[model samples]
Target chain A: MTTLAMTGRPLLQVEGLTHRYGSRIGCRDVTFDLWPGEVLGIVGESGSGKTTLLKCLSAQMEPHAGHVVYDTREDGPQDVFALSEPRRRLLMRTDWGIVHQHPVEGLRMKVSAGANVGERLMAVGARHYGEIRGAALDWLGRVEIARDRIDDMPRTFSGGMLQRLQIARNLVSRPRLVFMDEPTGSLDVSVQARLLDLLRGLVADLGLSVIVVTHDLAVARLLAHRLMVMRAGAVVEEGLTDQVLDDPQHPYTQLLVASILHP
Target chain B: MTASPSLSLAGIGKQFTLHVQGGVVLPVLAGVALDVAPGECVALHGPSGSGKSSLLRLVYGNYRAQAGSIAIRHRGQTIDVAAASAQTILKLRRYTLGYVSQFLRVIPRVPAIDVVAEPARAVGMTAAEAERRAERLLSRLRIPERLWSLPPATFSGGEQQRINLARGFVVDYPVLLLDEPTAALDADNRRTVVSLIHEAKARGTALLGIFHDAEVRDQVADRLFAMRPPSMAA
Candidate 1:
C-alpha cells in the first residue's frame, strides 16, 4: 500500500531550478511536483541544497533561475520567484508559515509568546495588543504550553518546548502551507519521537500541507507520504515514501539507507 | 554502572525575592537537589513551573543559588560552581562543561565557526587550528559549510543548534547540560539529532538535560528526575 504513490494535480511544480554560488553546485535543474495535502520529504546530506530549496519555495531566497509555482488549493497557481515584493508580502503575510530545526529561528526570543504569534497577525494588519496576546495564548495552548508562560522569554524554555513555541508561532497564523527545515535536528532520540508524534498529530488535525527538509530516512518514513532524495544539488530519487526507502534506486540513496544504523 | 565522575546535588537549593507592585520578594527555586555522573545521561522531567530548568540553570552557573552548594568533581578536583571564581568557572566551562540552553545563549555577531572554535582558541590553539577543527565538527553535525562563515543568527534553528553542539564538543567537555534540544523537529530531523546524541555519549560525554518526551528519556537517559510540585520542592 505504501508503494502506491498518490496521483493528483500538482499543487506545487518546480521547473529547472538552477541555483549557484560563484562556481559551486547548488541544486542544478531541480524539478518536482507536490500534490495537495502531501507531506513531501526532501532528504539529503549536508550541502545537498535541501535547505536552499526550502528557502526558495518560501520565497525567502531568490533562485538564480527556474521557477516555483505554488497552486493554492483554493485559488490558482502562482509563480513564487516572479512575485513582486508587495505580492510576496501579501502571500507571506497571509498564506505561509515556516518552521526551522532550531526553535529560536522562528521565534522572537525577547518578545512574549503572544507577540510572537501576534507578529504574524500584525504583519497582516492586526492592530490591538490584546487580540494579539489572546491569539498567542490560544496558539500556545494548542501546542500544549501553559498560558502563563506566554510572557516568558523563549530562552527559559527547554529545547523541546522552544520548538513547540516555534510551531505555535508559525502555525497560529493559519497559513495553508508551511515549510519545515530540519524540524528536530537538535533533540534527543526519545524527545525526537514525541515531538514527531506531536507534529504528525498537529499536521493531521490542521489539515495543512507541509514541505519538510531532512537528512533522515526514518523521519521521512514516519511522517512523509513521499520522499525525494537529493545528491550534489539534484533530486536523485523520488517516489512514495516506502518505495524510495524500501527499495532505493540511486547509489547515493542506497548508501544513505545503509547509514541508518539504529540500535 | 560504571564510575565516571558524577554531577550530584545534596540539599541543592535556590531562592530569589522579587518585589511585585510594592517591593515584594518571590523565591524562584527552593531546596532543589539532583545528580549526574560521568557516562550518565540523566533527564529532568517536569512541567513548566516545576523548577526543572531552574535546576539546569543552577548547574550551568547562570543562576547563583541563594542557599546550598553546586559542585562537580573533575580531573581529581571538585570545584564549587557557586563559589568558583569567574576565571575558574570560565576555565571550567571551557574545558570541562558544555551548557546548551534553549536560546542562542552566546553573544551574537560571532561567525558560526568562530562561535564553535572560541573555546579551543581560548586555551591555546592557533586561529588556523581552531578554524580547521571547527569546520570538521560542524560538518560532522551536518551544518552546511556555506553557512559556517555567517553569524549563527543568520542560520535557521536547526543550523544554529548544530553550531551550538559543535561549540559544546569543540572543546571536548566531558559533561554537557542540554535544555530540550529537539522540541521543534517534525520527525526525521529529530531522529538524526537523537542519533548524534547517542553517538556523543558513546564517545564519553556525560549529559544532563531537561526533556518533555518520554521516548527521549528512555532512549538516551540513564536516569530520570521527575520534579515534585512547588510545595514539595524544599
Candidate 2:
C-alpha cells in the first residue's frame, strides 16, 4: 500500500521499537511518526502486540530495545526513554495525556468529578481554587456532563459518564499529545457517537495529536488519519486510513476486513 | 391515495435569536423539505454550521420550528412534531421514536452491561432476559467479559460507546434517528453498526442520520439530503 505523506514535523517518532515478555515478542521493529494535529490508529487483534507498542510509545513501559523520541514544548526533540524521571513526569503532566481502556484506572474514583478534573490543572501549577474549579466545570460541560454532577464522586457516575469524566480530566490541561487505548471501546452506540463527536471536536479545536490503539477498524476509520496494522509483534501494513482500510495490500489486513460482520 | 412518508418535513425553517447585538437574527435552516420512507436510510450531508443536527432535533421535537410542519407516522396516527404537546411528544418518544445520539448520558455506579440492558428492561423484559440480550450485543461489539460487571465509570471511550449502542438499539423502534452512529467505532465495530442498521431496516424502521465519514455514509445511506449553510444557500 502507498504510505501516508508525513506532514509538518513529527511530534512523536518511534524507531525499531521492540518489547518482549521472555521468549514471546510483544512487538518488534515497530517504527512510525505521529505528526502534530494528526491521529494515528494502531489496529490489531488482542495479543497482536498493539498494546505493547502503545505502552512503549507512551513511556509507561521500557522496551527491550529501540528509541522513542518526542518533540517537547521546551526541548526541541528528546528521546523520551532518556529523559529523567522527574522530567518525564513533568512531560506527562504537561505535554501528554493517557486515556486508559478503563476509566477507573485513569481516574480517581474516590474524588469528586470536579476534583478529578481540577487536580490535573493543579498538577500543572494552577493554584487558584476558583480558576481550577471554573476550568473543571467548563471541561465537564465540554464532555457533556451536567455541571451539577461535578461535585459527585466518579464511583457514583455511570460507565459512560465516568468515561466522559475521565476524558474531561485528561483534557482539562489541553495536552499536545494524547495516547488513547480504545478510547471508545465499551459504551453504547448512541453514547459512543456523541463522545466521538466531542472528541473529534476537541482534537480539532485544540490541534491535539493522538495515538489511538483499537481493535475496531471503524473507530480507526472515523478518528484516525493514518493507520498501522500489526500482527505477531510486527507491522503488517501501514498507510493512510482509507488506503489501508479500503484496499488493503496485506493478506492479514484483507482477512481482518473480511472478518467484519456484514449483517 | 398513497400514504404519507414515515417522516415528512415540509418547508421547515428555524432561526436562533442572538442574545447580544440587539437580537441579531440568524437563520440556520429554512425552506427545507424531506421525506424518509420506511426501511430507508437517509443521510443528512452538510458542512459544520449547516443545521443538519438542528433539523434532526426539530423532528425529534427538541427544537421548535418557525415555519413548517414536521410530521411522523406513529401507531397509525400522524403527529405534527411542530405542534405536538410535551405529553404527546413524550408518549411518542417512549415507543415510536428512537434516537441514537453522539453522546451517552448514563446513571452513575451502574454496571456497563446493566446500562445497555436498561431499555429492554424498561419495556417489560425480565432483568435476566434484558441482560442476556445486552450480553450478546456487548460481546458482538467486542466489550470484554471482564468489564461487563464493573461500572463503566472506568471504561474507555470506545467501550462506553459500545454500551451506548447496545442501549439505543435494544428497543427496536419503528423510526430511528442517528447522529454519526459509527463515529467512534473501530472498523470491526463500524461493521457491527452497519449490520445493526441493516437489521433495523429489515424491520422497516425509517432512519435519518448524519455521516461525516464518507466511507460509512456510502456503506449504509440509501439516499442523501444536501444541507447548505444559510450563506451558501441559493
Candidate 3:
C-alpha cells in the first residue's frame, strides 16, 4: 500500500517525541504513525537532529519527553520507553532490526560471518544445528556472498561487504520494523544505488515497516514512500513521497529540494 | 506423459482473521491461479499490499492458505504445497526450492564462505564440493578473497547481499523463488546475477520473482502478474 494512503494499521506511533542533549533540543514535538510495510524517510541536512530522533525512536537513547508505541507481534501495543532494558533488547533482536550508518557499529567484528548471521536466528531461539547452518548459508547467498567463508571474521571484509554482512545479521530473522540510520551514507555512489535497490525490494518483499534517517534527498526520494523533513529539531513538512519531493510547500523544503546536488 | 508445470496454483485464497479487530477477516487474495513451466520466469508486480509477497510465501509454504492448491513438480512428483505435511514440505524445500530475498540471514560466528556453501551441504553435497562451489561463486560475485575467511557480520549491505545470492544459487533447485535478487548489486554484480539467473533458467529451473527494477525484470521475466490490493479487490 502507498504509505500515505493510511490503509494498513500503523505499526509504530510517535507522539510529542522530544529529546535534548543538555540545552540543545534533539527533536521537538515529533509526531507520526508508520504504517505496516511503509518506509518513512526522515530527511534533513547534517546536524538536523535526524540521527538524534532516530536514536530515540530506536531505543538507543532515552528521550527527555515523548512516547514511542510499537505494535508487538502479539497484536498489542507497548510503549518502547517504558519497557525494561532486557525486554527492549529482546524486542530489538526479535521484532526490530536496526542498520547503522557505520557497518562496524552494527556487526560483531570478532565473530565469523556465519555466526554473525546465525546469531540473529539463535536470538529468536532457533536451534537444530543443521537447520541453523543451512538457513545461514541461504541468507548469505540472498545477500550475494559466497558460502565458503562462513567461518571468517568480520575484520577481513571490505567496507561494502561489511555493511552487507551487518544487514544480513540484522535481517536474518525478518524483523517487522527496521530502523536504518544512514544505511548507505558512507558508501560510494554506485554502492549506494545498489543498496537502495536492495532495500526497496526487501521492504516490499517482507512487508517491513522502515524508518530511515538520511540527509540525502535522493536516498529519501528513491526508497521512501512518505517523507518527513526535519529542520532544527522540528518537522517542517510531511507528505507522500512524490508530493513532498516534486512539489515542496514549505520554503525550507523548497530550499532543500532545490539544493540537491545531482550527480 | 507430459511433465506438469513446475509450479501450479489454482484458486488460491488467503484471509487473515484479525482477532484484535472484533474477529474481522480480511481477504488478502482470492481465486488466484498461476503456473510456471521449467526454464520459464514469472514476475509478480503490484502496488503495496496487493498480495504479491503473500503469493510468494504461499508457494514457499511460509503462509497457510485458506483455499487453493499449490502444486510444485520435482523429480516427477507433484507435491501440493498448500496441503503438504510439514515433513513433506521440509523435504521438498531441502532439494527442490530456492529463494533469494533482499536480506541475508547467516549464523553468527561462521565464516562468509561457509554461509554461502551451506545450501549445497543441505542437499547431501560433499562439504568439500560445496566449499569449492562457494569459492567460485564468491570470486565470480567479486567478494574479496580475504573476506572469505571472515564473518559477514561486519560487511557492508552490498557484500552481505552477494553472500545471500550465492547461497540461493548454490543448490540449483528445480523451482526458484527470487524476491528482488539483484536489487543490491552494482552494475557489474547485477550483470553477474543476471548471468546466474540465466544459467539457472538454462538448467530448467522454474522461477518466480518480484523485481521492482524494470530493467532487470525485462531482462529476465517471461511474464508478469498484476495483483490488486486486498482492500480494493474485496
Candidate 4:
C-alpha cells in the first residue's frame, strides 16, 4: 500500500510558502508535503535563507505569504499561521518542537538537565514530580547521558552532551513534528557524527516528522530521506537525497556537491 | 517461469543537463525497455558509463527518469515509480522494492546489525525478530561476531559489501535491485552472494542486478540485457 493511503493525510503541508525580511526575500514560493515519519532536509550555504524558512515553518516567525497547514491530533488540517496566539503556543508546547542551532538557545541554562526535560512534560500538563523526574531520567538515558548527571546544570555539560540534553528536552513531550536548525552544526566532527546517529535512531523509532536545515551535505544525506536545495532565497532543486546528491540536476547543486573536500 | 513481470519499464529515457557546462545535455539511456518476471533474475550487461546503474536507480526511484514509466506490481496494484509521490516511493521502497548499491551508506556509529536490520524493522518486523534475522545473515555471510556491534565504516571493503548484501536480503521484498553486489567480494563471500541470489529467485523475487563478475552472473542470472551508451552506440 502507498504511504499516502496508509497515513491518510500529510502531517504537514507548505503551500507556496514565502517569507521576507523587509524587502529582502527570505525564501520564496516553497511548497512540499511532509509525510508521517518523513525527514526532509533543507540545505544551502550561508545566507541562503534556510534558517528563515525554518523560522516561518516552526511558527516562530510569520510568513509574508503562503500557508503552513498542520494536521493536529485533535483537529484536522488547520492553518498554523491563522491559529490564535495561545493555541499556537499550545501547539508548540504539545505537538510541535523546535531545536535551535545552539543548545543554550533551546535549553534553560539555570535549571538541571532533568528539570529541563521535566519542564516540557510539565508544560504538557504532566503532574507529580516523581513521575516527571522518572520520565526525565528515562529520556536522559535514551540520549546517552549518564544517570548521575541528571541533576547537573546544562551549562556544565559538554557541547555534545548539551545538544543531547536539548534533544531530550524537545522530545520528552512526544512532538509529532520537529523543526531543527542545524542540530549538529556547533559540534566537532566526531561529536556531530555521534549526535547524528542518535538523531537518526530516535527519528526512526519514534516515527517523527522532521524538517532539518543544514549546510552540511553529509548530514543531510545521513538523516534526510528527501532534500530541498536553496539558493538566493529560493529552491533550486528538490528530490530524493541520493538523487539530488548523486545525479545533481541543478548546477548550483552540482557545484555544492563538487565543492566538498574529499578526505 | 512465464508468470507476469513484477517490474516493468517501457520507453524509458534519462538525460543529464549540465547547466554549469553551458547547458549541455548528456544522454544516458534512450528508449530503453526492460522487464523482470516473478522468480527471474535479469543481469544488466554493459561497460562502465553505459547507464546500467542509472537504470537500477531509476527503478528504485532514486533518479527520476526524464520520460516513460516504471510500473511495479506492489501489493496487487501497479504503481508507476516515475510519477509516484515521495511518500508512495518511500512506502514502495520499504514494503515492495529493495535496493543494494555498490557501497555501504549508513548513519555513523549505528552498530552493523542495526544497519542491516533497519529495513526489516521498517517493513513491520519486530526489533527482536529483525535482529535475529540480521544476526543469521551476518553469520552466514561470515561477519565476525565481534564486528557485529561495531560500525561497518572501518571494515575492509569486502566486509562492508557483505554487510550491504546482508541488509538487502534481510527483508524479503518482491522486487530487488542490486548494483555490483559482489564486486568487492572474495570467492567465499561471492559464493554466499550467489547462493543468496538463488534463494531470492527461488522465493519468487524479481531481481535486476549488475553482476560485473561473469562467474556470479552466469550462476544467478536467467537472462542478460545488454546496454551500450546511447551516444556511443551511434
Candidate 5:
C-alpha cells in the first residue's frame, strides 16, 4: 500500500538481496521499495557494503543470492538478473546513470571535459557531434561550470567543480534514476551547500529518483526522503530520513547520528 | 619566508595560444605569484578556468611559462623549473615533482601501486624502496590492501583516488602540488583525504592545491585566498 502511493509504481524493488566478493562479504539481505521522485540515502562505514548494494540494485554488479526486481513504466517488476545481459545493459544505459565517488576515476582523464559529458549521449546513439557538443555545453552551464573549461582536462577543474562536471555528464542524458555516491564529499561546505541546492532542484525538475550512498547522516537529513543504515554489509535500520536520523533504534545507527553533528 | 621554497612561483602567467586560421594567444593566468614554505599547506580557491590547474602545471614543470619564474626545492638543492638546459619539460617533471592531477593521469595498464611507485623509480629510488613506500602510503590512506596490486583502472572511483593520494605522497618530496586532491569522494573517502593532508603536513612538505570543498580547506589550509577572476583580479 505504501509503495503504491506514488503514481509511477515502485521504480525498484529488492528482497533478500545479497552479494559477496570472493571470501569477503559485501551486502547481505537487502530489501526495499523505491518510489518515484524519492531520494534514498544509503549510509554506512568504510567497510560497509553500501556501494555493493547500490551496484547490485543498479545492475552494475550481480548479487550472489536473492533478486533485484525493477518496476519500469514500460514493464513491471522485471527481475534484473533474469534478463539477458544485453537487455540488462540496454535497460541501464538508457535509463540509469551512475556518479562514482571520484569524478576523475569515473571519467576519462585524458579527454576534454566536454567529451566526458557527451559520452553518455554518444552511448545512447546521439551520433551528431555538433548536437552532442551543444548539449554538453548546456549541461555544463546548468551545473554552473564555466563553459570555457569545457575544452580543458578534468585535472584542470577543482575537486568540487570536477564533481559538478560529473553530475553534468550524468544528468545530460536525463536518466530516470541517478545513482550518486557521496556527491558533495569533495565539495567545500559552501560549495556543498550550493551543490545540494542544485541537486535538489534538478531531481525535482527532472523527476529523477536517486539512490545516494554516503556516510554522513547529516547529509542524509539534508537530501534524503528515506534513510537506510548499514553495518558490515547489512541493513540494520531503515525508515523515513528524519525518523531514522533523529530516533535511531540501532546502536550503530545512533553512533552514525551522533557523528552527524552540524557539519 | 624560508630562503628556500619547496615550490615557488613569481609573476607567473600562462596563456593557451590557439591558432584558429591565424595565430592568437588566449591567456589563462596572469601575474600569479606565491610560494610554498616547507610544511605549509596553501589552498587555492578560484572558479574553473581561473588558472588554478595551470598554476599547478607550472609548478609541476609540465610547461614553461612565458612570463615570471618558478623554483622548487628538491632535497637540499633548488631545481630551477624554468631551466635553460633542456628542450623538454617532461624531464624536469620526472625528477622534481609528484603531481596527482584531477583525473587518472597514470599510464593505462599500470597497477595502482606501481603508478604511485613509478615516480620514485624515476627519482633513483630502488625498486624495493619504491614498492615499500607505495604500500605504506596506500595502507595509510584506507585503500583496501587487497586492491594494491590491481591496476588503478580496475579500481572503483574512491579506490583510485586513494591510490592517487598514496602515489603523490609515497616518496618524500620537498614539494607536492595537487590540482584537486579530494574532489570526487563519498563521505568516508573524503575523511581519508582530509587525514592524508594532515600526514603530508606533518612530514613538512609544502602543499599548494585548489579545493572547492570547504571542509577540506578548513581542515588543513594554513592560508586561504579568494582569487578574483583574472580581469577582476587585475
Candidate 6:
C-alpha cells in the first residue's frame, strides 16, 4: 500500500508502543499517527489489548516500550511520557480528555451536573459563578441535556443522559484531543444510536482529534475515519474504515467483518 | 458540450482479491473511461454485475482504484480522487461532491430534518438557514411535517428514500453521484426526484447516476454510458 501524503504534521504519534501485564503481553508494538479533526477507531474483541493500547496512549499507564509524542501548543512535539507529572496532569486537565465507558468512572455522581461541568472550567482558571453557570448551560444544550436539569445530580440521569453529561463535561474545556473507550457501550441500542449521532456532530463541529476504542463494528463504522484491528495483542489490520470493513485484507479482519450480524 | 467536464475518468480499473477464498482475484472494472460536463446528467446502463456501482464508489473514493485517474474539479483545481489523501477526499465530499446511495446510513436517532440539514450545515450554512432549507426540501419531497422531527429509521422505506434524496440535494454540490436513488419511491416522489435532478443540472451541477427505473432515467439522463461485465466483455 502507498503511504498517504498528509500535508501537516500529525497531532499525535505513537511509535513502537508496547505494554505488558507481568510477563504476558498487553499490547505489542502498536504504532499510528492521528491527525487533527480525525477520529481513529481501535477495534478488537475482549482481551485483544484495545484498552491497554488506549491506556498507554492517553498517559493513564506508562508503556513498557516506545514513544508517545504529542504536538504541544507551547513546546512543539514533546514526548508525553517524559513530561513531569504536574505538567502531564495539567495537560490532561487542559488539552486532553478521556471518556470512560462507565460515566461514573468519569463523573462525580454526588455533584449536580452543572458543577461537574463547571469544575473543569475552574481548573482551567475560569472564575465567576455566573460565567461558569452560563457556559455549563450552553454545553448542556449542545449535548441535548435540558438546562433545567443543570442542578440535578448525575445519579438522577439515565444511562444515556449520564453519558451525554460526561461528554459535555469533557468538551466544556474544548480539549483538542479526546480519548473515548466504548462511549456507547453501556446504553440501550436506540439510546446508543442517538448518542453516536450527537457525538458525531460534536466531533465534526469541534474538529477534535479523537482516539476511540470500540468493539462494535457498527460503532466503529459510524465514528471512525481510520481503523486499527487488533488481535492477540497486535494490530492485525489498519486502513481506512470503509476499506477495512468492506474489503478486509487481513484474514482476522475478514472474520471480524463477516461476524457482524447485519439485519 | 463546450464547457470543460466537471468530472472525468480515465483508464479506471478495480479488482477484488478475496483473501479467504485462497487469493482468488475478481476483476470488476477495467479500462473504464467517462466524463460528465457541467449541467449534464449521465446514467450508467448495464446488467447487475457490470461494475456500475463499483465505478461510482471509485469516483467517490469509497473504494480505491487499481489503475487510472478519477479527476474532479474542486475549488478551481483538479483533484485525482484515486490518489488524493483521505482528508482531501473528505473536503471534496463536503463542498464539491455529493452521493446518494440506495439506503440511508445515518445515526438512527437523529430527526429526519436534522439528518437532511446536517450536510448543509457542514458546508457553512447557519443552523437556521440549514434547517430552513431542510424543511423546504422535506416538504417538497412530501415527507409530512409531523414526520420531519422523527427519525427516518421509523419511517417507511419510501419515506426513508425521500429523506435520503433530500439530504443529497440539500447541498448544491458541484458534482453528484446517485446510486438507484429512486428505487423505492412512489410515482409522485419519483417525479419530485426527476425535478430535483433537472434543477441540479440547471444549476450547472454534473451528475453521474445509475437509474434503474426506465421512466426516471429517460426523464433525467442526457446520455447513457453502457457498461458490461468483465467476463462478458472478454
* Per-residue alpha-carbon lDDT of candidate 2 for residues B96-213, written as tens digits (9 for 90 to 100): 7888777775444567887788777656689899899999899889999999987786777777778788887888888899888788889999999999999999988999999888
For candidate 1, write residues A224-245 as lDDT tens digits: 8777898889999876665466
Per-model C-alpha lDDT, please?
Answer: 0.75, 0.84, 0.84, 0.92, 0.76, 0.92
Which run of 10 residues does model 1 chain A get worst, by summed lDDT? A1-10
Q: Give the TM-score (0 to 1) of chain B in model 5.
A: 0.86
Query: CA RMSD for every model?
Result: 25.0, 19.9, 15.4, 1.7, 24.6, 2.8
Candidate 4, residues B116-156, lDDT tens digits: the string is 99999988989999999999999999999999999898999
The reply for model 1, stretches above 4 Å from the true place, is A1-8, A72-75, A128-130, B1-234
Kept native contacts, fraction for each prediction: 0.00, 0.00, 0.00, 0.47, 0.00, 0.33
lDDT of 1 by residue, B111-176 (tens): 788788877876578889988989888777777778887777667777777677677667666788
DockQ list for all candidates: 0.01, 0.02, 0.02, 0.52, 0.01, 0.32
* Residue pairs in collision within model 5: A159-B183, A187-B213, A188-B212, A188-B213, A188-B214, A189-B214
CA shift of B110, model 1, Å: 41
Docking class of 2: incorrect
lDDT of 2 by residue, A29-138 (tens): 98887778778899999999998999989999999999999999887889998999999999988789999888998998888999999999999999999999999989
Candidate 5's error at B24, in angstroms? 74
| lDDT by residue (tens digit), candidate 5, B14-38 | 7655333244566677777788787
TM-score of each: 0.51, 0.54, 0.53, 0.96, 0.51, 0.91
Backbone collision count in every prediction? 19, 48, 79, 0, 6, 0
List runs of model 5 lying over 4 Å from the truth: A1-6, B1-234
Error at A215, model 2, angstroms:
0.5
Model 6, span A23-133: residue lDDT tens: 999999998889999999999999999999999999999999999999999998999999999999999998999999999999999899999999999999999999999
Best candidate per DockQ, number?
Answer: 4
Screening candidate 6 with a backbone cut-off below 3 angstroms (N, C-alpha, C), the clashing residue pairs are none
lDDT of 5 by residue, A2-55 (tens): 111124467888899989988888999889888777788999888899888888
Worst 10 residues of 6 chain B by lDDT: B83-92
